[model samples]
Target: MNKAIVVTGTPATGKTTVAKAIANKLNLKYIDVNSLIRTHNLSEGYDDKMKCDIVDTDKLNRILKQMIKDSDQKLVIDSHLSHHLPKSYVELCIVTKCELKELKQRLEKRGYSKAKVRENLDAEIFDICRNEAKEKGHNVIVINTSEGSKDIDDVLEEFGFLKQFEA
Candidate 1:
C-alpha cells in the first residue's frame, strides 16, 4: 500500500510550503487541493471576499478521494480540511501552526482582506485543524512554524520521518 501524508492547518500557516518541500525531498507527489479546486473551476465564488465561501465541500471531497485512489506514488496533500477526509487513506496527518500575529501578516501580504485574515487567525487560535484531526482519530502531529529557524527537515525528524534513514 502506498503511503500518504496530509499537511493541514489554518490558512497562511505554511502548509503548502512544507508540503511542497516534503514532496520534493521525498520524491512524492504534491497535491494542492486548493489549486485543484481553482484549476477545475469548481468554486462558486471568485471575488476576494467570497472566494473561500465558493468552495463546494462535497465536490472537493470527491475529487480528493479520486486523487487518493489514483495516486501511484506517495502523496503529500496540502489543504485546510485534510483531516476530515477518510483517515484510513492517510498514513500520516500533520497540522502546521504559527503565531496568530504572523499568520495575519502573511495573509495580509497575500492580499487577503482583514475579514479573511481575522477569520483564519481565529480558526488557528481555536485549534480547528487539531480538533478535526482528533475527531477523526488520526495521530496528528502539530508543527509550530512561528520561529524562522525551524525548517521542514526539523519537523520531519521530529515526526520520525528520518527513521527511514536507519533502515
Candidate 2:
C-alpha cells in the first residue's frame, strides 16, 4: 500500500518546509492541502480581509481521498487540518512545534497580526494538533522546529524516511 504522511502544525511552524524536504528525500509526491484550497478557491470568503477559516471537513476529506487515489507513489501531505481527514489513509502523522516566542516572531515577520500570532501560540502550547491526532488514532510524532531547518531532516530520519528501503 502506498503510504501517506501527514505533516501538521500551527501556522509558521515549518510544516510546509518539512513536508517538502521529506518528499524530496523520499521521492514521494508532496501535497500541500492549504495550497490546494487556495488554488481551487474551495473556501468561502478567503480574501485579504478575511482570515482563512477551516475548510469543510467533508469536502477536505473528499479532496484528499481523491488525491491519494490518483497518486502512484507515497505522499507527503501538509496541512493544519490533517487530523480531520480519514485516519485509515495516513501512515504517519507529525505535528511540528516551536517555542512560543519564536513562533510569534516568525508569524509577525510573515505579517500576521498580534491576535493571530497569540491564537496560534495558544494552540501550540495546548497541543491542539497532537490532541487531534490522538483522537483520530494516528501514530503521532511531535517535532520542535525552533532551532532551524535541520530539525525537519532530523524528524524525517527519526521516522525512518531517510533510509532508502524504509520509506
Candidate 3:
C-alpha cells in the first residue's frame, strides 16, 4: 500500500471513516484533501450556493503528485474530488456508496440546505464518483457503506490491502 489510495464518493458516503480506517490499519498517512486545499490555497473560489470550496483540480493534482513523490509512506487521500487525480499517481481508488434513502438521511442530518442535499443525493444515485474514477483509468473498487455497514474493511481485504500490510 505504499502507493496512493483515494477514498471518494458522494458527500455523506463516509469517505473519511473508511479512508481513516484503512490508513490506520496499514499505517499509511491519511491525507485530508479538504485540509490540503485550504493549506495549499488550491481553492478556485467559494461556492456560496453549495456552501463548498471550488478546488483548483489541476493545482491539487500537481501538489498531490509532488507529495506522493516526496514521501515513501503510503497515503490514503480522502475527498469526493480525489478521483480526479491522475491514475498514474494512484494505485487504488475506492468509492463509497450508500442506499439512496440512507444517503439522503445522512446528507440531511449534516444540516445541508435542501439544494445541497439534493445535489449530493443525485451524485450518489447516479454513481458520479465511480464513473469518474473509471473514466480517469483508475483501478477502482466500490463498497456499499449504508448505515451500520462497516463492510469497507472486507472490501479492502478482498482487494489484498489487508494482507499486503500484514506484518
Candidate 4:
C-alpha cells in the first residue's frame, strides 16, 4: 500500500470501523481526523446545532499532508471531511453506506435529536460522501456495510494489499 486511502461517509455509517479494519488488515496507519483536529486545534468552533466541531479545512489539510509526508506508513484517513482533501493526496476513497432502514435505526441509537437524524439520513440518501469523492476525482469505492464485511476483504485484495500477508 504505497498510497493513502480515505474512509468517508455520513456519520454512524461505519466509516471509522471500516477504516480501522482496513488499516489493520493492510498494515496502514489509521489517522483519525477528529483526533487530529483536537491535537492541531483546527476547529473553528463547535456547532451546537449539529453537535460537532467545525474544522478549519485549510489548516487540517496542511497538517494532514505534512503528517502523510512525515510518516513512511500508508495512511487510512478516517473522516467525513477526509474526502475534502485534494485527490493527489489520496489513492482511494471509500464511502461506507448502510440500508436506509438500518441507517435510520443506527442514527436513532446514537441518541441524536430527531432533526440531526433526519439531516444525516438526508445526507446519506443524497450520497453526499460518494458524490463529493467523485467530484474530487478520487478513485472511489462504496461499501454497503449492511451487506457484509466480505466486500472489505475483496477491496483489500483488489487493491493489492493482501499480498503482503502472503509474502
Which candidate's TM-score is highest?
3
Per-prediction TM-score to the true structure, in the order listed: 0.86, 0.87, 0.91, 0.89
lDDT of 2 by residue, 45-133 (tens): 54343266547768888888877777778888999887777788888887888888888889889887667777888998898988988
Clashing residue pairs in candidate 4 are none
Best-fitting candidate, scored by lDDT:
3
lDDT of 3 by residue, 68-163 (tens): 888778788998988898888898898998999988888888889999999988888789999999999999988777845466676666667554
Put down candidate 4 lDDT per residue, 1-167, tens digits, no spaces: 24578899999888987898788786778999998888878889998888889888888888888877777788889999999888878888889998889899999998998888999999999999899999999988887777755466665566574444221
Worst ten in a row by lDDT for model 3 = 158-167
lDDT for model 1 comes to 0.79
- Which regions of candidate 3 deviate over 4 angstroms? 147-161, 165-167
| Alpha-carbon local distance difference test for all models | 0.79, 0.79, 0.85, 0.83
State the local distance difference test value for candidate 2: 0.79
TM-score-best of 1 and 4: 4
lDDT of 1 by residue, 1-167 (tens): 46568889998888988888778777788898877987888878766673464677678877777778887777788988677777777878889899987888888899877788778888998999999888988878888888767577776666566345221
